[model samples]
Target: MTHNPDFKDGAAYIGGEFVPIGEAKISVLDWGFTRSDAVYDVVHVKDGRFFRLDDHLARFERSMARRRIELAEDRQALKDILVRCVQLAGLTDSYVAMVASRGRPRVKGSRKPSDCANHLVAYAIPWIDVIPLEVQERGAKLLISDHPRVADEAVDPTVKNYQWSDLTSGLFDANDEGFDTAVLCDGRGMVTEGPGFNVFAVIGGGLVTPERGCLHGITRQSVIDICGKEGIVCRAGDLPRADLETAEEVFLCTTAGGIMPIAQVGERVIEAGAPGPVTRRVMASYTAMHEDAAYVTFVDTPTRFAAAE
Candidate 1:
C-alpha cells in the first residue's frame, strides 16, 4: 500500500476513509478495543472477488448476535468497504476480514452510539494449498494435544473471536514438540477441531466430520458438496480419538488453508503416508470451481449515504 504522510503510516480503513494502518484511529477506551469481546469473519477472495460472499456475511451477522454486538455496517455497506480496501491494496484472491465489537465507552461520558463498528481489514496471501508444500513433501505429522476444545454448549467454536489463548497454548506445545499443527477434542473426547481448522476422516467407507461444534467452515462444506458430484459417500457424526487413529485417511479443512492431509497421526503412520485420494479430488475440484467462479464487483461510481453526508 502507498504510504501517505497524512495518515498514521499504516495502511487501514477508518470509518469510510483509507489511511495508513497506524494512522487509522479508534478509541482505546472503546469497549471493542479494550475488551476482546468482539466477533469477526474473513471471506476468501478468488480472482479479485469474494467467494460465497453472502454465506460469509451471514456468519458474521450470526457472530454479532452471539456476541451481543450490533453490526456497525449492514450487508451492502460491508461489501463496499471490503471492495475499496482490496482495491487499495491491489490484492487478488485474498482474504476480506471484518470485526464487530460491543459499543461501549472507555470513559463514562464519552459514549457515542455511532462508535459501534464493523471494522475492516484486508490482505492477500498465496493460496494456502491445504497441505503445506514442506509437509506434503516430507509427509505431514501431528502431535495430538491433551488440549480441550471448548464445548459447543459452553462456548460455540463457530463464533469467530479473539479469545485464542487456549489454542495458542496447544500450538506452542506442538511447535516445541515439532508438529505441524495442534488438535483438540470436545468435552466428550470426540475430536472437535484443530487450532484453526476442521477435521475429517475416511472411515466406514465414507468421509466424516464432527457435526456443528467446529466452525461451519465454508471450505469443509465445499468439499462435502464436491463429494456428492464425484460419487464419494460422506457423513457427519461424532469423531473420537481412536476413530481417527484407526481411520483410513485424516485431514483438515479451512478457508485460508484448504484441505490439509494428515500423514502421521502421533507416532503411528497413517495409510499411504501422504495426501489421500479423497482429499486430493476435493482440493482439485475446489480450485477449479473458484478459478471459474462468478464474481460480483463494486461499481467504480460512488454510492452515498446522502442523509449522513
Candidate 2:
C-alpha cells in the first residue's frame, strides 16, 4: 500500500489502467473535448474520509443517464476507482472527480451521438477551494454580471455538464472589475449561480437561494438541512437582483468550499464588509457534520485499493 513518489502530485484512472495524473489524456477528436459532450461530478475527502459519498455517486450516475453516456463501470466500480486514485496519491484530503465522456464516433465521419463510444475517467488531486482561503476569511467580493445564464430549456442545469460559456464570460468581467467572482442571472434578472457554486441570500431574517437555473448542489442541500436542524428559515425560490443586492448577508456553497461568506455584491457592501453571525454559525455546523458517522465514509485504502486492482 505504499504510495508511489511519482503519484505524489496526483493520480488518475484511465483506459483500465492507473497512471500519474499528468499522464492522463483523451483524444482530441473526442466529442467530450470537441463539443463539450460530457458529464462530471466532484466529491471531496477530508481527514481521510469522503463526505456524502453516496449522494455524490447518485448524482454522477443520474448525470450520465441524463446525458445518455454509458460507461463500462457501474456505481460500485466507479467508487472503487475513485478510492484507488486517492490511495495511490497518498492524499488524506483531496478533490476527486468522476467524469463520463462521449468519445469519438465508432464509424468514420459519423454525426450521431449514439455512434460515439462513451467512457469514464477519474482523478484525485490535492484539496482545492473554489474561493481561496484568504478570500474566504475576508469574505468574497462578487459581481452581478451582465452575462445571463444559459436558458434551462436549452441546457438542463440539473445535469452537471461542461457548458460554461456564460459562467466563464461573467468571471472574466468580474476579474476585470477587480472582484473575486461573478454570479449570473436569468433573462428576468433573477440570480442563478456563480462560477462553480450556488448563491444564497439572507433577507429579512430568512435564507433564500435560486430555485431554478442552477445546479442542485450537495452543499446547498447540506446548508438547508443545517437550517432545518437549527430552526432557521431557508427556502429555494426566485431571488430578484434588488433583493439580493440589499440582503442582510450573502454566501455561496459548493463541494470545493462549504460555506463562503460574501462581503459585497456589485457596488453595495454588506454588514460593513464582514461575515454575518448566521453565516458563521452555518459554517461551524457544516464543518462539525464532517465528523458525523451518518455523513462520512472513511477511506479504506488497503481494502478498497487491493480489491479494485
Candidate 3:
C-alpha cells in the first residue's frame, strides 16, 4: 500500500508504516529499550547516493544474527526501506540507520526470550560526524580513559549493540580532562578504541590497530582496502598504550566521520600534532572513491515524492 506524500516526507518507518520522525516510537516494554537487546548499523549518503550500503547491510545482518533477533524483512526489503527513508528526508547528505530489536514479550510477565518477537526500525536524519568538522580540521585530542572496555565475553563488540556504558564513562573522563575524545584500553592495558570510532596508529612506516576489543567498523575496512591499493602496509593486532603514545601518527575511522587524524594522545603529540602525510593520502583517496560507481547506491531515480517537489 502506498503511503501519503506527507507520510513519506521527512518521515520514519515504525512498525512497518511510515510516519513522521517525531511520532516514531517503540513500546516502553521493548527489550530493545529496556535491556539494550538490539543491534544497529549506519551508512552515510552523499549526493543522494549511499556509500557501502551492501557492506553495512551485511554487517547489520551479522549483528542481528549474533543477538538472535529474527525479523520478517530480508536484505532487499531493508535496502528499500533505507532508500525510502533518505528520500523522505530530502537529504543529499544523511545518516541512515537500521535497527533490529527483541520486541516485548508476548506474555507480559514472561522471562523467556522465546516469548518475544523481533522487530525492525530505521531512520535517516541529517548528516552526523562523530568528530565535528572543526575538530577534524584542528586534529583531535584524545584522553586515555582509566575505565576499561567491556569484556568481549560479557558483550561482543563485534555485534553493534546499545551497550555503551563503558564508552560513555570514558567520554565523561575525557571531558573532565579537557580533551576532545577518549580511547579506552582493555584490562590488559592494550589500546582498544574510542567512543564510536576505531583507533589506528602509524609506526615504523606501517599502520597498526587493535585486533580485539573494537568494533570492526566499515570505515576501518575501507581504509585497509585503500591501503592495499595504495601499497601502504596496514595490520591489525594488539596495540599497547605505550605504542599509541609513541606512534608517529594517529587517526580514527568511523562511518559517521570517515577519517579523523589525531593531534595528541594525552599530551604526547603525534607527528608535530597535525594530520600526517599517510593520513592525508588515505583521506584524499577515500574522498575520491565517493564518486566511484562501485560504492554508491542511488535512491532518487523514481523517488515517490519527486512529483510533489
Q: Rate the local accuracy (lDDT) of all candidates.
A: 0.69, 0.92, 0.88
What is the C-alpha local distance difference test score of candidate 3?
Answer: 0.88
Q: Give the TM-scores of the predictions, in the order they appear.
A: 0.83, 0.97, 0.95
Best by TM-score: 2
Which lDDT tens digits does candidate 2 get at residues 42-103? 99999999999999999999999998989999888888888888888889999999989999
Identify the runs in model 2 with alpha carbons over 4 angstroms from their true place.
Answer: 1-5, 301-305
Residue 105 miss distance in model 3 (angstroms) = 0.5
Expressed as tens digits, the lDDT of each residue in 128-191 for candidate 3 is 8998999999999989899999998888999998899999999999899999999999999999
By lDDT rank, best first, the candidates go: 2, 3, 1
> What are the per-residue Cα lDDT tens digits for candidate 1 across 1-309?
234433212134555565544555566765657767677777776666577777778888898777667655778887666655555555565656676766455346655544444454432233444447777666677766887876677677788877676677778878898888877776688887777788888886689888855887877788788888899998878888888878888878787766777888877788755677777777788787675435244323243432233
Whichever of 2 and 3 has more lDDT, that candidate is 2
TM-score of candidate 1 relative to the true fold: 0.83
